[model samples]
Structures are given as C-alpha cells and as structure tokens.
Target: MRPLEVWLYGAGLVLSFVAIVSLTRSIVVTIAKRKIVEERKAVQQEVQKKNEELVKQSALVESEYFVEREAREKLGLGREGESVVLLSPSATEPGIAAPVPEAVQETKSNFRLWWELFF
Candidate 1:
C-alpha cells in the first residue's frame, strides 16, 4: 500500500475514536444532570409539604379553644364561680371508679392526646 493511503487510514481511525469518546462523555454527563434535577425536585416537594403543615399548626395555635384550654390546664385558672378540683390518683381506678375530674372530662383532640401519651 502507498504511504499516503496508510497515513490517511490511521488518521481516520484516530478521529473516529475521538468522536466516539466525546459522544459517550456527553451521554454520561446528561444522565448525571438528570439525576441531580430529580433529587432537587424531591427536596422541593418535601419542603412544600412541611410548609403546609406549619401553616395548619399556626392556625390551630391562634384559635380561641386552644388558648382557653391552655389557660385552664396550664395556668389552673377559671371564670367566676368556676372552681377547679383536684383528685387523688387512686380515685381514677377503672374497676371501682370515682367521679372523673372536670379537667379530664374536657376532651382533647385525638392526635394531641396520642402525642401526649407516646411522647
């Protein structure tokens, strides 16, 4: 074969090899960028959910019922002629029950009551 033909063939092979490497590199980069985008979307969704939960709790805290309940329970306070009563733990026995206290009779939200029991 002529020297020029051999050199031309070698150059063509090298250029094709370079093209293939560049294509594979770009594909890898594109896949990595897609994964990063998905992760960011997941994180944004989580943040949005947490923000909604905070708004719900803020509304609850602002309610009159929550304020009155907190004042009565935490501060041991009442309106005029509304006496607070205390009872012994033994009086609360289920088998031979005594009168349930006023504070205990005041119903709590199921979630709040469960949270208090568990946490």
Candidate 2:
C-alpha cells in the first residue's frame, strides 16, 4: 500500500477509538446524573413528609384539648365542674381489674381503625 493510504487508515482507527471512548464516557456520566437526580427527589420527598409531620404536631400542641389534658395530667388541676380522683397503688391489687387509663385510649383515624378492623 502507499504511505498516504497507511497513514489515513491509522488516523481513521484512532478517530474511531476516540469516538467510542467519548460515547462510553458520555453514557456513564448521563447514568450518574440520572441517579443523582433520583436521589435528590427522594430526599426532597422525605423532607416534605417530615415538614408535614411537624405541622401536624404543631397543630396538636396548639389545640385546647391537648393543653387541658396536659395541664390536668401534669399539674393535677381540673376545671370548675370536674373532680379529680386519685387511687392508691394498693387499690390496684393483683385480683382487681384496673380501669383503663385515658391515655391508653388512643384516638385512631377512621382509615386506620377500619384497616385494623379488616386486617
């Protein structure tokens, strides 16, 4: 073959190699970018959920029922029409069935209650 033809073939081979390497690198970078975007979206969703939970807790803390319950339970104070009852430890003996406390009666959402009933 002529020297010019050999040099042209060599240059074509090198160009093809470079193109393949460039394409492979681009694919890897694109995949990594997509993964990063997905991770960021997941983290943002988690943060939004936490913010919603905080808002719910804030609302509950600000409610009158929560405040009154806390005051009555913690401070041993009651409203004018209410009377407080205290039971001694000995009154809750092994044979006697104790009354269920108010705190134990959790207020469940209707959805949760139905789910629990069905499931």
Estimated TM-score for each candidate: 0.63, 0.64
Per-residue accuracy of model 2 over 1-119 as CA lDDT, tens digit each? 99999999999999999999999999999999999999999999999999999999999999999999999988888999989987668676778776666866678899998999999
**Clashing pairs counted in every model:** 0, 0
lDDT string for model 1 (19-108, tens) is: 999999999999999999999999999999999999999999999989988988888888789999865787777687775658656778
Q: Tell me, by lDDT, which candidate is best.
A: 2
lDDT of 1 at 1: 88
Candidate 1 C-alpha error for residue 29, in Å: 1.8
Model 1, runs deviating above 4 Å: 91-119
